[model samples]
Target: MLKQKSGPSRRKVILIGLDSAPPELLLERFLDKMPTIRRLVKNGISGRMRSCDPPITVPAWMVMMTGMDPGQLGIYGFRNRKGWSYSDYYLTTSTMIKEKPIWEIIAQTAGMKSCLIGVPPSYPVRPIMGNLISCFLTPGLEKEYTYPHELRDEVAEIVGEYEFDAAFRSDNRDEILEAIRRMTNKRFDLANYMIEQKEWSFFMLVEIGLDRLHHTFWKYFDDTHPRFESGNRFEMVLEDYYILLDKRIGELIENCGEDTIIIIASDHGSKAMKGAFCINEWLIREGYLKLAERPEGIVSIEDASVDWDKTKAWGWGGYYSRIFFNVKGREDKGILTKEPGGDLDELVTELKEKITRLVDNRGVPMKNTVFSPDELYKTVRGDPPDLMVYLDDLNWRAAGTIGHGKIYLEENDTGPDDSVHSMDGVFILYDPRERIRKDIGTMSIMDAAPTILRRIGLSIPKEMIGKPV
Candidate 1:
């Protein structure tokens, strides 16, 4: 195991995850839209971040936190079991997490403290050696925030107690954008609290705008449909939001202490899902899947509460490109009856071949590929997917009601927020001493964990399939 790098250079690291920022979007709009990111791209070593299989947000965040693969963390998509809609659980404190995360390892070795703020599914704060502000998955732990309790007056002054809600908006775009601005204001205030009142070794903060914007407004941002009839109606408004977010990044830079080692990242890239490609739908066609019942008619899983033990597989996982395969015994008392045998090696091969057969609306075969449950399994102690699938740049990204899944027109069915696997990767430094590997290739979601641990001088047990970035 590489001991924490012996030097003053690796002090006080701050990782800021831009939930769904993508390279293509940045390239197209950074100079014109986001000056903060443009500054970072020019000054800091940052670029495209690769994502994990199915590339769902929960797993991606988990990967960044653990430096392990989905196989080990067993956080493939959100829920171990489903209720309805196959959209993985919106991870929170209650979600199952199985792995020795970076926070634990850092406390063990670095003697440095950490402050986690608004990170996805990072609930309960775990009583680590640092302070925390829960977000994404964790709700109701608002009391533990840096200032909410310690500096209540200041936190209240900057941002009201409008809790962090990922689906902060309704169908109204203006409402959505305003909500984001408020959230951003709150984030800035929280970061200010850390800089002024706290002394910590490591820190992390998350901005959900990227993910939320992409899911609801990607159609407004892009002109050409890489596949579908997308391109938001209120394109200018969405662009303004991007610019505003960029300014936030710039402000964060200005607000932070000069010595803080700043890092910006996205869990995965984002792209337009031509149409919802119901994975279960394809599975049924392929003979590998069997849905207990047709979801009645088309319904947005989000609005329709699914019977965990009934829904088989769901396609839209989250912004990190994940798909959940609901097997019989593996899930929360799994609902799917057509279960796979434990032979992952053989299963993976079969899955890959079948997934390869899928084509885009233009009738072109999707590339990248799929990993078998065996190939993807990390043996992490928890409820994990029996099999997981992957899609490349040309195909992976998906959303709903705009995405590849069955669209629901009902008010509850197609809400303002949807799902996607963003294309942008987190900006990471393999070793400050070692010039970054220019061609380290796109960073996978699973790679982030091991890499962080390795950076801090810890060992990722061999059982993990992912390694240091």
Candidate 2:
């Protein structure tokens, strides 16, 4: 059983997540542009919320909702290894989560209804107390993406083909901007309709457009960005988008009743991409990773040309690096073991030392650090990486591309990405009827779930590590 708090009327709690929203961007850069968010910060509780380790979208939101670390949730990154296998990898989904999220707990344990709209990792929609609309990763607009199944058709009829996200990769900027506007408008409209029509105690939605804009055009906004140009046409693109977002946010707040509490947060923050640290290329040079043959062109790790027998350690790179050891008895073609002075310990130490000392072309040390899973996570479960690393204070992202012939890559190996996920996201709590604390300095994203429960006069689960704010 869970510890409960006595209350009278059940009020609604609305949580809005702006993906990759940072305090640097929200509080400092665009403060003047977004009046609603600015007012929320000035009158309510605001803080710099630390995101999960690796701090990418997939596991971060799960950590925020479940109050569980990535290891405990059995999810380490967007692409997780399928059990103990060395080569197999799969994208994470809501179904893969081992623990119950806050919405489900509210619905089942407290008998309070919840409507989760556009929350990531919620593909293959499950039955909830009220309604649910799965987020960005949904395969297509044609698929059944909403709960009650028929809800999809209804939303289509009303919003005219719901947009999961903008076409950020396209060359035409106008098309991307138009798509973003259309998507944002439709999502806001749908959320408003649900709020008006649905009977629920908890409502939550996450906007991913901020993340898409940062990834595609961060250079245009940040003057210090390496690719930034003076007086570019897209200079005000991100700021303009935030203003538009603020308008929608104002609308949401205006519609909420006096009993409602609005909590705005982000999964992770964003920053300009300095460069890509090619992990596989570095491993090849250090003799930790072996290839069947020296290739003439760039290749991905999935190319099946790697010699697993001779490999001691290898890593895949994203905003962070996930290092894996071919330990005997743990992998299919295992070679390394945990014995004293063996490849596992010695190589890990050596890699850590070498990576920490890395510097950029401007003679600035990366200021990077490496960690063992045991040192960071409270409980080590699932198929977790052997080591995790951050580069240049997360200014530089990791690239797993091999055969690049250099330790550094000027461009992202995956695609045309200008930014990477930062470790610090933003969190703000506002309630007009109540005298909310203004000095809530700093908190982890994990604290949010328990905080939401506390605000709505519900019990906090024993499994949750977060305490009430």
Candidate 3:
């Protein structure tokens, strides 16, 4: 997707990602509140980006930064299922990534240094040009103080007394709040210190707070929920957070020299997903699947858990589900040659359509589309799941292509789950006309890297999925 161009690049680019930040929240509403973001938008080019197909965090981020598809990055969805294989959650730096990342390109070609703080799945740091301090969804962190012969005192000061490891998955709100405060403090300290110490070419920071809040509180903030929180519900909460988040961003930009370029982008927007669809269960009910042990009719899912060795596939977590084709060689005890077939594709398409056509428990039709690897992929190297299913505004889907059947529709989907991710990610750019930034349509989980590079005067790599903006 590289179209070579000649141009003057900014010496310094600061890309701040407000994870799951929706453009609506920032359009004149939270500008005063999110001073930093507001300032960046005002001083730079800004726009609303529509995320790619199956707009989950992992794939979406990959799309935004590298401009590559999920098929290329090998990051299919929230968790990937490989046939009778167990599903594994995706964290950025996980061994699952299959393509060239934007960081490598920036460091290798741009002749610039970067400071990346707390971008998800970036923890087990890989080869890169700058210092990377990572956390898992802002909850799990390795304090610089813990590093061998660490500068414990200095790192502590920079990270502040608070450190948030709050994940949307965590059931505890107290812990979540504490983690958020800590994470925010650490993000602030890290960005500030990095800018001061390093003549950084790009300083990229992503705020995971908004995303977390949406996941945990969407139910309390939406009209459908009897427990919807806040008198203003989700909309007002967004504004409040924007105002608070803005001040932090403002401070970061305040210290920057006029020559420095600051850009703000989100991996993808958020939407509410309350209904749950366990594709694996649906397959079993349809007789497409069989299990050795069904767990005495079901008390709780844990009680009814199937024999992983017996079932063809299963899925869980978040607003999506993965359907695995039980093929041999690919699975622990696979049955087929693991070849891709038209049958497999068609079956998935049918199931996906059925899932999309579903009405929520409240009887509302889901709105979304399914993307095969080719469809999800725009680049030669696509990072898509075996099959990708994008859901409606309030409904999302996940699937795994690890089975042998042409169509292994589940008899039951995971139970009716409440809440979904947010749809409000932000994008503010300086000189976005850069070849790297020109095609950026929407933000995703993967965009932070290359965008950071472009801001710092680095050219995106030919092999990488995304380029600098």
Better of 1 and 3 by TM-score: 3
Q: What is the C-alpha lDDT of each candidate?
A: 0.57, 0.84, 0.55
How would you encode candidate 1's per-residue C-alpha lDDT over 1-469 as one tens digit per residue? Answer: 9544324634556677778767666645555666666555555455567776646677677777776666666556665544422444544242356566666677776666777777767665456676767676644434454423555455566566745654643667667766676777678667766756666667788877667777666656566534224543566755676677677666766666665556677777776654444444454455544444445556444544444554444554332234455555555646444535553335455665766676665667766455445655545435444444454443443332222333212122334443346445656442334433343446666566566655555567564556665
Runs in model 3 deviating more than 4 A are: 1-10, 81-102, 137-153, 160-164, 167-175, 222-238, 296-317, 328-346, 349-353, 378-385, 394-418, 422-424, 431-460, 464-469
TM-score comparison, 1 vs 2, better candidate: 2
| lDDT: worst 10-residue window of model 3 | 404-413
Put down candidate 2 lDDT per residue, 1-469, tens digits, no spaces.
8534224655678888899999898877888988888888887888888998879898899899998888778788889877767668989887888798888888777788888888978987878878999989898977779988888877887798888888775467767777787888899998888888877788898998888888888888898888888798988889889999999988987877776888889998899999899988888888888999977788788773889989888888898998888888887788888889987788888889999998885778898989998888888887788899999889888988788888887778887788988888989988777645584767898899898888777788888877777
Residue 188, candidate 2: how far off, in angstroms?
A: 0.6
lDDT, model 3, position 53: 52
TM-score of 1: 0.74
lDDT of 1 at 334: 60
Give me the overall lDDT of model 2: 0.84
Candidate 1 overall lDDT versus native: 0.57
Residue-level lDDT tens digits of model 3 in 268-346: 6665554445454556666545655554433322234445454444434345444455445565665434347744445
Estimate the TM-score of every prediction.
0.74, 0.95, 0.75
After superposition, the stretches of candidate 2 with alpha carbons farther than 4 Å from their true spots are 1-7, 435-437
> In candidate 3, residue 103 scores what lDDT?
56
Order candidates by TM-score, high to low: 2, 3, 1
